[model samples]
Target: MKKQFFCAAAAALAMISAAPAQAQPQTQDDPYQWLENIEGEKALDWVRAQNARSQEALEADPRFAPMYEEALSVLTSKARLALGSIHNGYVYNFWQDDEHVRGVWRRASVESYRAGAPEWETLVDVDALAEEEDRNWVWGGVDCLSPDYTHCMVELSDGGSDAAFWREFDSSDKAFVEGGFYIPEGKSSVAWLGPDTLLVGADTGEGSLTTSGYPRTVRRLARDAALDEAPVLYEGEETDVAVAAAVEQDNGGAHVFVVRSPSFFESEYYYARSEDDALGDLEKLPLPMNADFEGVLGGRAIFLLREEWTYDGETYESGAVIAYGLAGAEAQTVMTPAANQSVEDVEIGKSGLVISYLEDVSGKAARFTPRKKGGWKRKEIGLPDNGVIEIISAGGGTDDAMLSFESLTRPEALYYAPARGKLKKIAETPAFYDATGVVVEQRFATSADGTKVPYFIMGLDSVLKQGNAPTVQYGYGGFLIPILPVYYEDPARPQHGALAGLMWVKRGGVLVLSNIRGGGEYGPKWHQAALKENRQRAFDDFIAISEDLIETGVTSPEKLGAIGRSNGGLLMGAMLTQRPDLYAAIDCGVPLFDMKRYNKLLAGASWMGEYGDPDIPEEWAYISKYSPYQNLKAGEPYPKVLFYTSTKDDRVHPGHARKAAAKMDGLGYDFFYYENIEGGHGGTANQDQLAYRTALEYAYFARMLMPRSE
Candidate 1:
């Protein structure tokens, strides 16, 4: 259910937990600042040399080849469900495999897709385009005109970077329109206002982007007109995160929205009556700054509250879903979470809202339809309970959805559910590894502050009874993301227990997914519990889980390993420096280590709403205590960590890993380091690259935690 009207703050905040980094000024205290030079030969030389060394060491292991093959096989398996969404009477899908490593944009009729056998028509072959143009192009996404959906804007990223080039595409003809609407790359956003017009937010020139490196100004670009000369609809402050535009064209007309995000969580929304409206024609919507724009439904704009707000003299509590009429009516309540409930994924379908939520750390889903009489009519979509549920594909002009259900040990089942219709099991992935003896269970660990932190532990029942087993705990406790016990995650680039099952668990290692504070497992309150100064609570929660594992005789400190990326990578750093004795190895991938300078690097400034600004002395007082780089001590019993990042990770600075590794090297600590030359924040561009990295990770874990014979 990805629409132009996603939570602006959450989208920006994702860069912290879901992306990578680079770019910063050199300081006297930072000796490894040269690594921040994204394309500098000197920096690249160091990265290349380190990659060679780490790859040799990890790939030399006997288990590496088989693991790589298995990962590749699973990633490229055709039996895997083709997750797609209905668009213009068809279901569109972006596919990648061993053949189409760069991926292909394909679509099939809705009937064929629902029948579980889509005769895909290739719209754009990225692998062919990359070869023909001699460019490292990655498929970004496409924004199309509503209804017809023939005219579209195709986004193409260079080597999987966030910044991308948008070109006019004609889906009807399946070709790029010559000299059609084009927006140059630079953390941009766009939507079709009409057949000949687009509402765009992009880096036009100097001062066009916010301090966070996102477009602060949005303009209306006419077909065949110069992007620079387009009419500026609105301008936000330089300090603001960014400004974005979305168009909702329906029976009424084209309703334009410009969301001006001043911070990660605060925003001001402006609206236009029609696509022809000018800058002055835009009217500001009276809404709370902390309120998030979900999407428009039945002439009303949907919102989710992150804080209590008395709107129109009525109070709406945090975590409440509300809707406001476009004709300027009082805000009405949509859905209020129950005592044990918190919403997770929200997708706006053509006629309904598909909400996948959590109840006491478990998954549930329902479709909310706007009733003519008033209030939202909720219809629960029945699926397997007590497992991870993901809305694979929804919206895109259809009430039908692609849903996935899986537990830690169970293979994922893909279902096609129609609006108020029965759930049809269209596809299911075969078990990657034998899970005959494997079992998954929910457990709670008491944190330092006496909060019950939920976590999922999966392994062989016999192994649990044996009392001690090598274990890997994976966590990402920030950005409202709940780490569910799915056998895998993201069909586009699947990883998790799915690969770990084949590579680690099957080889006698345990897997754990921690739902600590700073995540959405228990909703907003759970996340707020670990904000800024309280960030250590997340680390404490993770530490408590490790202690519980050892106390319960599950595994020992010498057999434990912690793995996380991005913000979770920061968590790993905290674990490495703060509680090194608890784990045998730490996989800190594309992590933010230099907390003091994080805001000054890449897109880190946008995340100030999450981790407070380090320049603020008061904030530094709380941050410095756990800031990994500044806190790194020479004699600390830090684990031999495996630090990895991408050379072009434009979200979190690669220098974070490079600097920390260099500092550790200076301290005479022996550790492994690797950097992918082509991957971006995700650290891998294609299935093969993903397979290679997956194999490397499992091999490292195998060597560090598994038994010698394995």
Candidate 2:
């Protein structure tokens, strides 16, 4: 469950001006800096040329067409479950397939949804709306008012960009409310205060945004008032990352909050008495700046701490969940994980709080109810071991909640856990592929620093014993994000490994998921161990896993392939330059390659806390060691890597991939490059595009790693 009161520091910005050439020391030295012009005609022409050349090469492979068809079937199959959240008495869901390319916002009653044959009501057909408006509108989400849930703010993005336009929609009438609350296209945050009032943070014109290009001022606006006429509730510094407002409705009452994010990981929260109350005089919550505000439950403000806090001689350890009364100063610890556990998520329920945590990289969930006197009691939810459990719905003005569970070889099952009843399975997804001989094992690799890095390996038992099977490994060792095992093809849960199971494992291949140091596998300390100067630890951990695989005779360097994206793409870059001979293929997608100028790129500055500032020489000394573009040599005999990115990706600039490929080309190296004309950071807009991209990746792996018929 997403937190109701929080502002994202890396919220997408409006139109960004290119950083001056003088700002980057490498700009003058790099010959392909012209690729930095994201929408430049010359740059786009180069992109198109590269796309055509690579598409022809990859598509010509005999395996391409079959793999594409298989991927499309898996992606568009109606057998896939439609996941949703419970709002009011309805289960709201957004679905897309071959027919509804853009998708549709629909809903059904909770009873019907649980029974499997839901009589779904299409509230909005995004494809029809997009065609009528002549805009490639992508559904972001809908923020609805609590209790009745009749009115909502529907977020629509053009070309799947993070920056979106919002319009008020009336679910009762199944149409956009005429003259209702509407916000023009920009990265904005809005929450419902009432049917006729809103708390918004968005691009309001010049001087209304921060230097990072996000809204620094949060305002309260009336239904028919112009944006400029809205009353300023709170204003933050331009140097801050962003500011936003949120309102949480519970049985106790509605709680309004103003969140100010100064950096990527720090935030200040203020509470307002009412929607029309002046936030300038709002009471500041007594919480750690690095703590995350989970939600308000039982008249208490719940917080998850990122760092240890000693308040009133009471020391609360880092990663502990605590609660404090909104009107009282006293606080109580709700729950704390053991050494082998880390809190992954916190969900507020109508009667209690549900905590989802990772125990030794496996998922565990429990319910915590506050005691009448003080403290809290925990009741472990009876869930299957060795599976990932996620809270699907909670705190919808009722004690009823839903949870979903799945594992690498197991199909997903949704359980309905009422406030006062036993957990019962309500729906189950049919297996997409056979797992007759498949087995999963948890193994650990010793890093350079002697840290045991855990990883999951899935394959046929007989195939593993034979040794030297073609293998592909995936890792995302940054941003405190943990990669768990699940059904990967489900668009709702893209991180799962199910696609690899169906496409590769069934074909006699091994799949590996590495839980390296810079992730939140074991909590804050595990991630902090690889911060800034120690960032190389993450790279070392990944390399250790690759070596461990070879040492175990699972696969040789000639049969090993590596895949990563975004920060993981950065990892792929490091892998390519630091140890190109370790793997046969590297698929770097929507990556951050040019560390020297990443800070000046889109949303790059917001991540300085994760990756140190490259502008500073002291920090550059360490960053340059792994900066792929800087480390690429003319005659390194590097593996022919396939680089893919999205032209509309407003988060990580597409230039990172374009320039990296160009530099490699100039160095007399062979590589493949493809940039989607649409999509965003995800690199694909809909199922068809996703299927094609997945097929391309798998085909590349097969071409490079599989044994040839000589």
Candidate 3:
């Protein structure tokens, strides 16, 4: 595995060196210098200045007005809102941007009757959440709600190389659930045993390894609430095991431990109760499964694995019936939607479970019931395909389940689906997002390889097709992360000018979402078609989609633009380097540009299973061929490119974006760079901070791609 990793990196490096040299331009200060020298206040100050300037330019653009008005209308409309389930009765939702708090995190009543009714009350003032605690702890990676939903865990760092716990939130009162422990600077991952049972694992001190490096012990939160009394539940060789999943099973008493080896292709599990007298005896379970596993669903282990046969080339889950009492072994084949279709969330209830499978046959969600004869009985739930479904559990008491649905043009509609019945309106998500002038539809385009690619297009119905009309195309074809409909009515969408698209669509502009390979638009097959050496297929598919727009007279290359973040950034990067002639503007944010050094960098090492090892001689030949950073050339008429990242982005190192920008500058490519000092993977940690960055991106797109009416 290690050898394969470095081989991929080597391949990437070879690709970089293989490129012909460009005529070096006049030397400028090394952009990477700030990365090494800049400290706290100074780094943040730089981010603020750049944002201020970008905002000023965007707000000043004359074309920004109408888009802003439309954006504001959709953002504040009452017809767009929903009550989504996050933890039992405590829901999760993003209210209107025009709210007094910018955006409120509120909890709502699951049985509220009228849609758009004021049933939710604020939980945490986001502004206060950011100010009172460090952003990294509160806004990093993903957060999990406790089984009881009484407390929330936050991962934090103290400026050392690694991360540690900074704070905890009391979910009941929506306040800080404080036990105060200044974990060593490098310590990370604070898992809760129960509501008050805390388990911290990591190295300690500024850089010193914790005893034997890595988090070797799972410490228990003591009865006295003191750090010293926190005894080690499991440590040493046992800690090396990767806990793929842990659930409160055995009647919400015993915790089942499905531990796994580090390999992406295997799974070895064992379960034990917290109160078990022999807690150390973790007996292995007899199950034919792979390392690629999903979390437990309906008290059953749900996961996808492939056969050893090379012909398999697919990821198939064992489904929700995997671990059920007598029904588990029978096995049910739950639908794995197209690679681009998201996995519909599974809601567990006592009456029966509602498993919403995404992108099955169509983009819409499908429902399933565990059958007496092995597999599940499937039924299509006719919800809009353009939007996503968020299932709200009624805590197993009520027969009715609430749904939060939204799309780009439709806003958000909160509905209640009572046990195998029709959907009734409850409330909109935004409670103020206007849908009076909205339209959305799914479109298909033929790829360069004759493959039919799917896409979701959104715009105002009043707009007419014009050749010169601006268009913004979006895509992300990696990790099977579906690009579901975004109900954000921001005026700063690409087609309109950062804020130009929202307003431009009202006049005439289009938003096209390319359902290319590397995404689950069709399912595992769609993604596998573009895996490893075939990565370029996704880019080719995207290019073909863009050409389709031009052929149909919807928009031309001169007025066309593109946007993608992270893996999608990688796509746009390849597009800019491989087909710069096809786009007028591009927004590449937090991208993995330097494929060669990606593994060595933060979190990049883990994704080798997706993108072949750069170190591998064979894989390098193909990977380097399309690697955006290494493939860049000089004296070429490259499209205007904007590269964005965050200094605190501990995942895909900011260096990826920084180094790419530096290379672009040295090669004299028409490019711009912006770096945020906070917000881990995301450019910002706070919603308002995110809004500011979003506005900046839209503004840049508007400035470069939005055609001037004058």
Q: What tens digits encode model 2's per-residue C-alpha lDDT throughout 625-672? A: 999999998879699999999888777888899999999999999999
Q: In model 1, what is the error at residue 331, expressed in angstroms?
A: 1.6
lDDT of 3 by residue, 637-707 (tens): 68878788877555566666766776787787656677776654556554445555565665566678764
| Cα RMSD of predicted structure 2 | 2.5
**Model 1 lDDT tens row, 1-710:** 22221111113222221222333446898888777777789988988888889999999988889989989988887766677777778988888877888899999998887787789999999999999999999877887887787998888878876667888899989999987887765577888777888888887888788878778888888878888888888899999887888787656477788988888767888987683543347788888887777778767788887778787779988887888898866688878888578877777788888888889878898888888887788988899988888887777677888888987677788889987568999878788788888888889999999988888888888898897799999887887767777776653223366777777777778988899998878777888889998999999999999999999999999899999888888999999999999999899888989999888777788888888989999999999999999988788888889998887677877889998998899888988998988777778788898888888888888889875574
Q: Tell me model 3's lDDT, rounded to 2 decimals.
A: 0.55
lDDT of the structure predicted as candidate 2: 0.83
* lDDT (CA) per prediction: 0.81, 0.83, 0.55
Report the Cα lDDT for candidate 1: 0.81
Ranking by TM-score: 2, 1, 3
